[model samples]
Target: MSRLVVVSNRVSLPDEHGSPPPGGMAIALSAALQRRHGLWMGWSGKVKAGEDPSGPISRREARGISYALTDLSQTDLDDYYYGFANRVLWPVFHCRVDLAEYSEARMSGYQRVNRLFAKLLQPLISDDDVIWVHDYHLIPLAKELRNLGCGNKIGFFLHIPWPAADILFTVPHYDDLLRGLSCYDLVGFHTDDDLSNFAECLRRQGLPDPITNGVCQAYGRVFRCGVFPIGIDTAEFERLAEQAARSETLQEPSQRIPGCKVAIGVDRLDYSKGIEKRIVAFDRFLRSNDHRIGKTQLLQITPKSRTEIPAYLAMQKDVAERVGRVDGELGTIDWMPVHYINRSVGPSELAGLYRMARVGLVTPLRDGMNLVAKEYVAAQDPQNPGVLVLSRFAGAARELGGAILVNPYDPEAMARAIEEALDMQLDERIDRWRAMIGRLREYNVYRWCDDFLLGLDQR
Candidate 1:
């Protein structure tokens, strides 16, 4: 069995020994790691310093996979994580061009952390181990690994949108970023547009130019670029939904939205999500069509995210005001145009929510690949599936064409798309669901891992 080493920003703290398993982004990657029960590496989320952070501090086994974690001090958490990674790269990568905060100190800290990660894992890494890294937080990890004279198959996948080269140019150090990415044997993005944007950046940064099929040969290594849109575990999500549908939580809502079609939108409360804009679009949707008052209900589940950031704080206030104003204008005592719910939901309940919805509204201004959109398709009823109103800006839009594509920035357009989805026929809805599911089932997470690994092997 070939060992697979997985790295991420943080590891979930296991509670009881018999828990199902820690399965998030990294754990999903652990399926590939299961053949060898390879090590999963990441920060333990505990603040510390002056200690040997180079070695694994803990270990656990679950679902035929093993996890290892280490602690990072307050300084590292500030500079390496909150300061550099989140405060800078996260906003920039998500296309908030104006909100980027460039700091030389943060950049240096970012580099140090990558080097630390590489140093800690280097000894544990065997020749047969494949290192699969995830997210923007670890972009320079492979470079650090390579710099230490460690040669192994390293593959990277970005879970967030890769901004257009023009937007990326806002950073003072765009060149350095791509230079780090070039170290990976295989680099994966969520869609062709993201790959194009990245490849465009590589060209501008004087990095090795990708040939005909987005292949770039440089540093005595063949870099294979690919667009592998991420997906949820469909069978598992469906099962959870089925179980949730029978729960009292879902039953309460069944009676709550009486005699009206429900449109559902679930997203983290973040600036990039455009939650305020979504509410405004829903307001337009209600104002334009008065008959919809008692006929249509918009269910928005916005769980708070990055609450500590000032920009995010302002966005939350803006969304609240927008939602309130819309309700004040269009909502009657018997019918509220928007049923807004703020806070996180377990996956089990999201499945039920998807089933009850008439439309899955995922219109992020820019998203790498919104898993919610794909999860919605997975939880649909083939006999009478709900419509997916997706943003053209999301990476999933490239593969899930059956979705009712809309530009989220355009309020009027989004409003019309919502109305159209609610009024769609069963056959058309089924056709669209089938097409979307075809792509989803075919290019699932399993296939995504396989494709990325194969590309890495060739390099």
Candidate 2:
């Protein structure tokens, strides 16, 4: 078996045993590296002045996995990361074309950084290694690697939605990006809808469709594509939740209002998360059910991200104003209808919060796969599970069909779904939870990694 070479935009350094991993990519890739003794490589999230683009990569080892990291020059960090990747690709991929920012400098910087990655990474890789690149930031990496004469079986996985051809073409140098994808031996998406959109994009360009068996021919090269929906380590999550449930820190928040049931939403402070819409819907829910104003509270924990970005700054103001409006309209001397926290909470605390809540609200305008939904489900008590009110546009909705699905675009619909979730029967909650848990247990993160690797191997 070939050693797995995992590459992503950010690499999570291995931490202490029994501590929850930082991100889903961290958990999944760490497990793969531990099982196969592979190398993980990525940017070190550092920007240095006058740093050589071809400098030697930094190496570290911890928790049975090896890491190779490189720092970006300040200019590259600005143009490549904050500029093109986040401003352009992130918005376009998530179907937010209105927010997409384009410039020649950013495009050139993106290509330069990818070429730099290829140069630095080439020395560390062997011909027998299986290379797996992750996310929109590194879409052109496989092409750069192939240009350097590394013929390893490379795979690419996009963690966000892949836009239709019409939307994708809106990006500058779109042909180059598509051509870079053709360099990969395999490509993976989170859901069938994403996979279909990708294939349709290719078809629009006169390329062959990705077959059910995951093989396609484009740019005179064979490419394999498949839906590899990511999952969590269910047993591990449950253990964390159990440990959290025992903590007083986790108990105090829910006990803030005696008899009040908590409905929770955890998301990054981003527009695509539908944070504003969620607030509006919660307000509408309160308006219609005046009797439940003090009886129920919507707790939205949205940690700030990319604060330097203009759009994110504006959204922060928007979310704050809306939360204030709702609270002003529905608050009493002793009780507030909504509790909005703009800071991050640790996993253990989050698990505790998840267990304490009576309803889990995951209503993203559009998402690849919102892992919060899965984590929420895993934290629920089997005897009295919390209902999941999910967005139909989320990739997780495809598998989590048992959830109370709603269109996030419509506040009234979302409000109705929240009401339905709140009024759901215990037996129905258990049945829905059991169905979701069955899928979670059957298709754990380990299994997703295995299946993708297996697909790449057979190709």
Candidate 3:
């Protein structure tokens, strides 16, 4: 078997001594690495002074998996990661062009980092290795590898939305990015919508059209592209929920509120998450229907992300004020309408809360795939499951059609959907949940990884 080489911006090194790994890509990629005797390579998540970006990779071995890590300088973190990747690419991909800050220095830094990665990775490559690059941070990496005379079949996957041609064209050097993307043997997106957007962007630039079979000829190269929506480890999440239900952590919420029905939202503190909109919808639900004010509660646990970024800092304040206003207007001495938690909780505790909640509000303005929606579904009680109020813009909404879909931009619509979810009958909830679970069981994270790898290996 050819070694599978996985590269990303940040590698999540698993804990030693046989403890279970973290969730999402960490767990999925670790399984793949162990199976294929692969090497995981990326930044070490440490900022050091005067460290060479293209220096020799420091290696660590854990649980039969080898990790090749390199440290980044503070300037690289600021210009490449914070400036180009987060400030420019992230917002543009999510269709928030207003937040994108494009500059020549930022683009140069991004290119320098890609060049550095390729230089460091060149010596690690064997003739039979197949490389897989992940996310927006490394779109140009495959091209850089090719420039270094590496012949391995390299695939790239984008884990975010792809904006339309006009929105995408707003970024400087958009053509260069597209040309870099064409260098990959295969490119993957989370949904057909994103794939179509990519195709349309190429067309608007007078590039050749992509066929229905997912082949496109651009920049004098032919590449395959496909949709591979990500999924959670459903079985693992279910087991965690079962264990969490019997733990003391769940007892805290019950003891605090006794019998209040809970609605939950878990996301990072980001402008694109529509956190404030969700809170306003919940507030609307409380104001319009006064009968359910004390009967229900909303617990939004958002761990802060990218706090150094101005947009994130502003969003945190905006969400906090919204939560405060809702509580002030609707709080009784015994009950508060919203419990906004800014810190992250343990996975087991989160599972317990998911099990406890009557409705899971995963209403993001835009997302690649909202894993929390699937996690909520997986954590629900089999006999009496909670309803999932999902945003139509989320990639998961395409697959989890059984969820109560709402437009995140419309607070009234979201409030109505939340009310519907809350008022849904048990039998209907079970039917919806069973349908979603059936899909999840058939197409979990293992399947996604396998499918992408299989596609990458094909001619």
Per-candidate TM-scores read: 0.93, 0.97, 0.98
Q: Write the per-residue lDDT of candidate 1 for residues 1-459, one digit (tens) a residue.
A: 468888888765445763434233444566677666767889887777564443345677776677777778677777888888888888889878688777898888888888888988888888878888888999999989988887888989899988888888887777778878889888898888888888777666565566448687654556778888777676677677778777886757757757788889999898777677888898888889878877888889998877767788888888888888888887788888888888987787788888889889999988888888999998887788999999998888888999999999999999999999988999999999999888878787777777887777676
Q: List the pairs of residues colliding in candidate 1.
A: none
TM-score, cand. 1 vs. native: 0.93
Counting only residues 3 or more apart in sequence or on different chains, how many pairs clash (N, Cα, C under 3 Å) in candidate 3? 0
Clashing pairs in 2: none
TM-score (C-alpha, index-matched) for candidate 3: 0.98
The digit string of per-residue lDDT tens for model 2 on 151-221 reads 89999888898888888999988888888998998899999888788878778788655455678777888
In order, what lDDT does every prediction score? 0.81, 0.88, 0.90
Q: Arrange candidates by lDDT, highest first: which order?
A: 3, 2, 1
The deviation in Å at residue 295 for candidate 2 is 0.8
User: Which is the leading candidate under TM-score?
Assistant: 3
Q: Rank all candidate structures by their TM-score, best first, as comma-separated numbers.
A: 3, 2, 1
* Top-lDDT candidate index: 3
lDDT tens per residue, model 3, 1-459: 789999999988876674436786788888888888889999999887675454458998887778999988888888899999999999999999999999999999999999999999999989899999999999999989999998899999899998899999999999989999999989999999999999999998886555458888988888899999999999989999999888886857956876788899999899889999999999988887777879899999999999989999989898999889889988989999999899988888899999989999999999999899999999999999999999999999999978999999999999888889889999999999999999998899989998999999994
Estimate the lDDT of model 1: 0.81
Q: How many backbone overlaps does candidate 1 show?
A: 0
